[model samples]
Target: MYEDFGEILINGGNRGLGLGFVKQLLSQAPQKIFATYRSAETAKELLELATNNPRVLIPILADSTCEEDVSNVAKMVSQETNKLDLVINCVGYLHNAEHGPEKSLRQINANQLLESAKMNALPTLLLAKYFQKLLKHDQPSVFSAISA
Candidate 1:
């Protein structure tokens, strides 16, 4: 099934899980791998990988939570190919230095919850909305979204 895959998109390629997917998928020899990262500072590894494999890998700078960024990414991908064989969304927000994991109901702050939703939940929906056209081929396609 993977051998026939022509194009693939990975949303959170800077993270370990997403980067692993990109590395493994390279074996399949897909025509293009569109990997999105929020910031250049955090995406050094991904940028390096892209530098090594320029023809196969394309690193895009995009903030998944922003609708405009997502839309622009879709447009950019469309310029390369009309169809995407697989899309893996690994952008998840569990906790940061300021906000740790909630241990109990009382620990669940409203703002943190909203921030979690924005990071963990919203990106996948927005990606689906904008990239649906690229995923609508006659062949089998997959869109997998990982959560926090």
Candidate 2:
């Protein structure tokens, strides 16, 4: 069903698991890829990958929490291609300097929980809200996410 699939969007695809997904997708030699990062200067690994695969990889600076960034990216993608075959959301806000996942109910804090929820939830919702139309509906299209 995905024989026509080519254009792909990877959010938060700068480092760690997100970067790993970028590598895996590159190995498949897709027609085009749009990878988003909050800060381009800090995404050295992604930048290197894009350098090595300039034609297939396109790095975009975007903050998942920011609606304007997401909307702007949608416009950019619209300029590049009419539709995307897949959208993979890899942004995770699972921890902050103040705290992390608690082992027990008592160990958890309201602030950390809210922070984690915002990070994990906001991006996914914003992506769909802004980019859903960019995905082909008649043909096979996929929206997926990763977290820990």
Candidate 3:
């Protein structure tokens, strides 16, 4: 998939599995990579990893839940590049510190479920909504979400 150089964007790329995906994708030698993290401080490792790698671009302080943040990122991508080959949405929230879904109907709370849906599902739809124009007409484009 990385044979032909192209731009890729990844959200929620501070740590864990999102970081792993960035590492593997870097190995493929894409033309450019724009990785967004919710907190700039949490992206120190990613910043260190990007040193000496010109293709890697770290755009910090983007919260997927915010409309302004999403719009800013879309604008940034449009100004800097002509086409976006891939956009991967890796943002999600598990219920509290327990780090798992509600065990039963009794445990479910409307607030928690709503938060989960907003974090896990809404961003993907939002990304598509904002950046659909950057996607090529003939060339294939991919929008994916990773959730727990």
lDDT of 1 by residue, 1-148 (tens): 7776789999999868999988888878889999999989989999999999988999999999999999999999999999999999999867988999999998989998999999999899999999899899899999989776
Backbone-clash count (model 1)? 0
Worst 10 residues of 2 by lDDT: 1-10
Tens-place lDDT per residue, model 3, 1-148, is 6655377888887787777778888889777777888876888877877775754665556898888899999888778888888888888766668546777788877877787888888888888888888876578887778887
lDDT of 2 at 106: 93
Q: Who wins the lDDT comparison?
A: 1
Give me the overall lDDT of model 2. 0.86
Give per-model CA RMSD: 1.2, 1.9, 1.8
TM-score of each: 0.95, 0.89, 0.89
Candidate 3 deviant stretches above 4 angstroms:
98-100
Instruction: Extract clashing residue pairs from model 2.
Output: none
After superposition, which runs of candidate 1 have C-alpha atoms over 4 Å from their true positions? none
TM-score of 3: 0.89
Candidate 1 clashes between residue pairs 3 or more apart in a chain or in different chains: none
List, in order, the clash count of every candidate structure. 0, 0, 0
